[model samples]
Target: MSRSVAGPEIERLIQLMARLPGLGPRSARRAALHLIKKRETLLGPLSDAMRVAAERVVVCRSCGNVDTSDPCTICTDAKRDPSLIVVVEDVSDLWALERSGAVPGRYHVLGGVLSPLDGVRPEHLNIEGLVSRASEPGVGEIILALNATVDGQTTAHYVTERLSHLPLKITRLAHGVPVGGELDYLDEGTLSAAIRSRTAF
Candidate 1:
């Protein structure tokens, strides 16, 4: 018969926080305690920010990226190359690529990869939107930056088949060993991909 430490409100907050990604019950309890201690400085401001984000944050209709605007900053940026579009599985993937600063073009988020076992299909995803976007003029190439999983490759193949009639070049991200990875530590799939995609040196 262990006694509960906090009141209903605090316990509710901790429970809610625990539902967030990467935060478990123990971490959520610690976070809730910290927030309670810093009610005025951290907690209040965070609550306000979350409320504002909840009100303003929206999914970009065109590209499927989450943003405060419809077209999103990436879509509206004039400096980005309009001829190229990198297709990713989610907004998180888009953000990862943005951090790299390697892509000077825009992005198209597919919402998710094709997973038949998980009941995810082409109709459930933004595949139609992608096809429509690819059909638009000034779009020359589409780079698929999907994960190297079976679902990701299946989605890529489906998209490629759908867009085959369109006069556009479709490509996928290159797979290989990491920059400093040793041969002994590398997996067979990675080794095969590295060999297959080897460049002329």
Candidate 2:
């Protein structure tokens, strides 16, 4: 039988680290060793940061973004266009879009896509909150920036239907081949979207 190399406490830390996204057992072990070697500079600060985040982080009531405030920094930003709202799948997607700096409007995080096979339904998402926000005065448009998947499309349709009676104009992200991407390597759906959404050259 193989004997355990690290003490129980260290082994527990490695196990917990392995559970983090993009980390596996081997990588976690390496990370744990590195942290131990740099306990003062890395591990100590990381532990403190994690504790603070765990204690202070909250879901924004207005846009569903995760932050230290109920309304979140994005929702509270007066410079952003309150008339427009971009609906996304998750907090991660919200971060990605924010990094792009392409959107000057506020955002609404759905928390997840509609995946019936995965037991995720409309009720499981933040659809009602989105409807409520869209109904507010001064809101003019809602842009669905969901993924190019069947579930994403289904959720978009459902949201559009739910807000159909409202005065807001509902739109979706344009689908097409990405920049610097080759047509030969593009998927059929992307190629078709590119053809259909072709612009004046």
Estimate every model's Cα lDDT from 0 to 1. Answer: 0.93, 0.94
Note the residue pairs that clash in candidate 1.
Answer: none
Residues 109-165 of candidate 1 have per-residue lDDT tens digits of: 999999989999899999999999999999999999999888999999999999999
Count of steric clashes across candidates, in order: 0, 0
How much does candidate 2 score in TM-score?
0.95
State, as a TM-score between 0 and 1, how close model 1 is to the true structure.
0.94
Error of 2 at 137 (Å): 0.9
* Model 2, residue 97: C-alpha shift (Å): 0.8
List residue ranges in candidate 1 displaced over 4 A: 1-4
How do all models score by TM-score? 0.94, 0.95
lDDT of model number 2:
0.94
